[model samples]
Structure formats: C-alpha cells, structure tokens
Target: METIQRTHVTDAPPLPSPWRDAHVAVVVPTYNEAGNIAELTRRIYDLEMPGIRLIVVDDDSPDGTGALADDLAGQVNESHPGRMVVLHREAKEGIGRAYVAGMKEALARGADFVVQMDGDLSHRPEYIPRMLGTIMAAQAGLVIGSRYVPGGSLSAQWGRHRRLLSRFAGIYVNAILKLPIRDVTGGFKMWRREVLEHIGLNTVRSDGYSFQVEMNHLCEHMGQSIVEIPIHFEERRADSSKISLAVQVESMLTPFALRFGRRRRG
Candidate 1:
C-alpha cells in the first residue's frame, strides 16, 4: 500500500490541505440534500484532521444541493484550490454510480483512502478518526461502521416494519453471500485505495442500497482484511427518505442475484 505524509501548515485563510497530502478523501453523494449541505460543509471545514479531502457529488438535485456545494467549495478554495470538488451529473444516478464516480475522483486526486456515507447527518463526522484508526491498526482494506456488531446499537424510533426489513435484509444477505463481517450491507465504510482497484468496481451492477454488499463481497474476494466496528445507526431526520419501495425491492433482489451468480461462478 502506498502512503503519503502531509502536514497542516496554516491556521489563517488559505485552507489548503497541506495535511491532505496523506491518503484521504471523504466522498458525500447527495441528491436534494439542501438542508444538510451547509452544516455538513462547515463541520468538514472546521475539522482539523489531517489528509482529509471533502468531495461532494450531486446528481442535479432539484433542491439546489449542487449549487450549494459549488458555493461551499468556493469558500474553502479561497485558500485551498481543488481542496473540494463538486461533480454534477445530469440526473439522479443510483448510489452505486455516485460512489464509483467519487472513487474515481479520489484516485485521480491522489487520495489513498476513500469513504462512502450518507449526507443526511445519520453518519456522524466524529467517527472518521476512529474508523481511520481501525483501518490502520488492523491494516484492513475496509472498515465498516456496523450497527449489528457487539457494541453497536440502532435507534429506537424506527417502526417495527422498517426494523424487521433491515434485520431480514442483513441476515438474509449475510447468509447467502457468506460474508464474514456482520454488517455486510452498511454504507458507512472506509476503503483502502488498493481494495477498490482490486475489486474491479466496474463490475458492480447494484444501483440501490445493495451496492454495499457487492463492494464488501469484492473486497473479501480479493483477500483484503475487513473490520466491522460497532456504531450507532440512526435514522435521517431531514428531507424525505430516499429509500423508496422500488429501492427496497432492488435492495432485496440485487443481493439474491449477486450472491447466487458468484456462487455459480465459483
């Protein structure tokens, strides 16, 4: 694994990522997350962590997330050009495409590590350092923020139906795919740059939530170490949930096909 050492040199304007010289980029894929973009950007900027790059990819969200992202990028780049990038696609692509696009950007921008997570505040920014530690300590290719792990917990507000669905999905997918980790379907994860290259991300066909499962499977297949750390999973508080009935259907069906297809091939 290739690594870079970077230093944070200034405290004034010119927010250049002197530290971002390290292998790091945080990718936040958004679709109509206008309410959350400003605070998210602020939190990311205020965070003094080294080697962290913030890349926002928006799919032409009608709520103006793309414009907000551009504006935020402008504010940050006043001192640090290219520190932040906003990729705008014509329409809403699936989560898989958004992440794959972000991964490509991370690599092109010379990031050694890449992260995928929701923009809805469900994933706390404070957890980034901890996940980074897991990645480094375990020398794992991927570190997952898992809700099903021993120390993990889920919010109590979700209704029984939603809870049941997620539970069933996790159990079913893990069983079929025979994944070693507990949270095979979680989106909050950090991926080593090499794992993404080895996984052949181009081959992942899932367009919905199941994208996580396929990515995890690919990493495990490549003989990369994976760690699942306990995390508190919370439901999004703002903007409507994007997990529509169609998305749910795809989530269930996609895993079945991927798991079985791989079995046959193996």
Candidate 2:
C-alpha cells in the first residue's frame, strides 16, 4: 500500500469546486482492500471535481483498510476539505449495508448524485466523467458501466469458466426478471439521488453480492430510466476474492425472491 503523508486542516476546506457545485458523491464500499485504497483514492481525488467527495465505507477490515482510508481521507481532506469521508463499520457485514450507510451519508450531505464502485480498482476512475456525462445528457436515473454492453469487454486474463459464469449470471437474472438492463450484475454505477431516495434504501434486504442484482431489479421495477455505457472490466490485482459459495447461493436465490416474493415497487 502507498503511504500518504497526513495533513491536518484548521477547518473544512471551502466547497467551491465543480464537483461540490454539482453535489456529486462517489461511495465505494470496501473490505480488506488496503493495498489498493491509496492509489484508488489518489486517482479519484486527482480527478479533482472541485466538490466531488469520495466516501469509503469500510467494514472494519482486519487488514487495517479502515485505517488506511482514514489516512487517505485525512490527506485528501487536508487539501480539498470535505472531499473524503470514511465510514468505518464495526464489523464486516456485507456490501449492501456498507452501501446503504455511504449513500445515506451522501444524501445527508446534499448530494445530487451518488456513485457505487468497488475499491479494488476493478472499476476505473477514468470512466467516471463519461458516466456523469451520460447521466446528465441522457437524463438517466441510473447509469451503469456495463461489461455486457457492446463496447464493454472483460480482461483477457479471465478464464473461460469465469467469463461463462459472469455471462450466464446476467442472462439468468435478465431472463427471470425481464429487466431492460443487460448488465444486471454490474457494480460500477451512478445513481441520481432521487432514485436512491425513491427506492428506500432501508427496504433493500440483500446482504451479499445479491445486493447488486437487487438494486438493479428495484430500479427496473420502479420504471426508472437507466442507461448502460460500455466499460472495460479489469480483474483485481490484490486481496483475495470476496465471492464465495454462500454469496453465489444468495445471488441465485435473489432472482426468485425478487421476481416472486417481492410485490412492492422498492
């Protein structure tokens, strides 16, 4: 992990940048991603969207990711002030809860839009500008950086089985839910604040990777306008994969539950 020199500020830096003026918040949920946190934060902060804030919702990673996030937040906030907010949870719950907490914080800060991404650097920060552009130009409630889209491609390093499983998951979820989205399992996404507000974050029940599918499902169910922009999906270089057998089981069960059990608009 990169070491960032800590800098302290006397007061919150003035929010006068384009990012702040637009009220854009990027919420990244993390667990044991210490190796990548600094670089990721640097890249996101380097974008320097003025008021663009990066929220790192850490699940109390034993590897000290939360502490590293604090360092990054301190360094970034020292210069940008209020541009980095790290929410350290008591224990590793799930991505769903981490996101809920971060999104709520974004909303509380009066954010107009919120972004969701993985902290392991799989989701490139370069595409953020385009995602934001698409959201505004297309007036989409949700903008997804999709691997299943025409121009999107997964890393060549991914094996056949991994590729097949990913493709199959998207196909299976879409078939069952009849969602207009092609990347039903995509994690790199941007959402208008209203979409999150309307979905009622507290009502979302998925506690594992299924959270991604469930969020997509709710957006489709609520008749929200969504746009998918093709993106290059890179494989993570550090830390063990979080996906496990239990998460896979939940991913499978989520489709059936959402399609049959859930009746509300979410």
> Could you say which candidate leads in lDDT?
2
Residue by residue across 1-266, what tens digits does model 1's lDDT show?
Answer: 11122333243222234433356788999998988887776666555565678899899999888988888888777777888899999978788889888988988898888988889888766677677767876899999999989999888887999878788888998878788988777899999988887776677777778788888888887888999988888778578888878777887887678756753221
TM-score of 1: 0.88
| lDDT (C-alpha) at residue 46 in model 1 | 57
Please identify model 1 stretches exceeding 4 Å from their true place.
1-21, 262-266
The numbered model that scores best in TM-score is 2
lDDT string for model 2 (1-266, tens) is 35563333322333333533577899999998988998888677655356578999999898898988887787777867887899989988888889989999999998888999999899887677778777887888999999988999999989999999988998898888888988889899999999999999988888888898999988988888999999999999698788878888999999999988954444
What C-alpha lDDT, on a 0 to 100 scale, does residue 54 get in candidate 2? 92
Give the runs in model 2 whose Cα sits over 4 Å from its true position: 1-21, 263-266
Candidate 2 lDDT: 0.85
Q: After superposition, how far is residue 87 of candidate 1 from its true place, in Å?
A: 0.4
**RMSD of candidates 1 onward, in order:** 6.6, 5.0
